[model samples]
Target: MKILAFSDLHRDKDAAWSLRDAARAADVVIGAGDFGTRGEGLADTFDILRDITVPVLVVAGNHDNLAEMQAANRGWPHLHVLHGSGVAIGDTAFFGLGYEIPATNEASWNQRLSEAEAEELLAACPDKAVLVTHSPPYGVADLQRNGRHEGSRAIRAAIERHQPQLVLCGHIHHAWGTKGAIGHSEVHNLGPAAHWFEI
Candidate 1:
């Protein structure tokens, strides 16, 4: 299947329009998250992406409210807002885990999970499934501007164990569009621009 993936839109209408056009040729469209600005205007992003006819999968970024996004798209059959869950499209199994591992960040919209919490949430992921997350795995497309690798160790462990076919993530703006690997899995730190892959 052809997958079109993007992340960290942050309510950019231009990016959304571009993604809409890109989605036409894709079997699936995946958004890694950060559609809103500090948990606001998320509905606007959804409105812009409403033209996509294919299956739309999204995870909540640290800047977004998972509950709000889920509630907003509750009635939309084509859109799936996933968090620590799995969904099947055709024969491919996709799993999602959103937000960052909890830290003493000052941002009020920053949603997080502890290392153990993340591992527990990811334990249900099926082997070789496509993994989607808002934060990248440790040391893999997760470098920060401060020259530090700010990623979840639990997430890395999960990827190592499950060996997903592909891992999609965002949040490290400086590492956007970068690619890495964990065992047999291809990991990408997607940006607002659409990325196409055949899986």
Candidate 2:
């Protein structure tokens, strides 16, 4: 399958259009997260993204609320908004988890999950499924400007246990386009552009 994955659009209409146009050649499109800015501006990007006809999988970022996103995308059949959930397309399964894991002190509008909370949410993921998360697993594709690894330990533990086929995430801007590995899974930090992956 051909998958186009991206993240952190942050309400950039041009980027949304870019992804929409890029979806023409992809079988599936994955939006890792950050479609909004501090819980606002989601509609700006969604308006353009709504044009893509492919099966689009998305998760809410720290700047977004899951309920708000689901409500906004209620009528869209092609767009699958996921959080702590799993979906199957063809023969592959995709599991998604969103927001900043292990919590964050950056802003009050930021939605976060503690390590234990993340573990509980991630427990339902099927083994070897494609893992899509807003935060990268601890120490993998999660390096920051300060050289700190801000990923969730629970996420790492889950990766170790599940050994998924691929891990997709975006949050730490410095780690964009970078790839790492946990066990045998390929983890990528997708930025605000189209990344092609074949599975």
Candidate 3:
């Protein structure tokens, strides 16, 4: 199926508009994360996404209010919020864990898990799955402005152990691209806008 992945739009309507149009033409659209500005304007933020014509699979980012987001998405068949959940789309099975690492300060939400907890989530998915997370795993596509890598050690370990088919994520906007593979999984970070690929 054709999958379009993008992230960190952070409520940019122009980008959302483009994505909405692109999404309608594709089989499915995946929003990696950072969909809204935290601490305010949630109602309006969801209004933007509610217009999407195709199936939209989203994972909450550090910038979103999960409770509010969950409420907003109620009864929307086209939009599935994958916050610690999995959804199937044609030939692919999409599994997601949003905000699975802790942030140092305010303006972010972190939910880091132990190796066992990580494994339990991975175990819940079928082998060779399409995994999605807000933050990229360490040493995969996670890079800082100075080229330093900042990602989850546990996440990396999970990928090494499970060997998922493809991983789609975005938390570090600077590392807005793709890394051929990490462990046995191919990793892609679609940040700051829209991108499409055949999977």
**Considering only N, C-alpha and C atoms within 3 Å, which residue pairs clash in candidate 3?**
100-111
Flag regions of model 2 displaced more than 4 Å. none
Worst 10 residues of 1 by lDDT: 100-109
Give candidate 2's TM-score: 0.97
Better of 2 and 3 by TM-score: 2
TM-score of each candidate structure, all chains considered together: 0.97, 0.97, 0.87
Better of 2 and 3 by lDDT: 2
Best by TM-score: 2
lDDT of 1 by residue, 1-199 (tens): 9999999999899889989987989999999989987878787778889778889999999888888888867666688988989899999999998887645376777787888888999999999999999999999999988989998898999999999999999988999999999899999999999999899
Candidate RMSDs in order: 1.1, 0.9, 2.4
Residue-level lDDT of model 3, residues 1-199, one tens digit each, is 8888888777787777777776777888888777776545545445666777677888877777767667766756688888657888877888887764535334334434544565566556666778888888888788889888887776677677768788889988788885758766899888856777777
lDDT of 3 at 112: 44
How many backbone collisions does model 2 have?
A: 0
- TM-score, predicted candidate 1 vs. hidden true structure: 0.97
- Which residues of candidate 1, in runs, are more than 4 Å off? 102-104
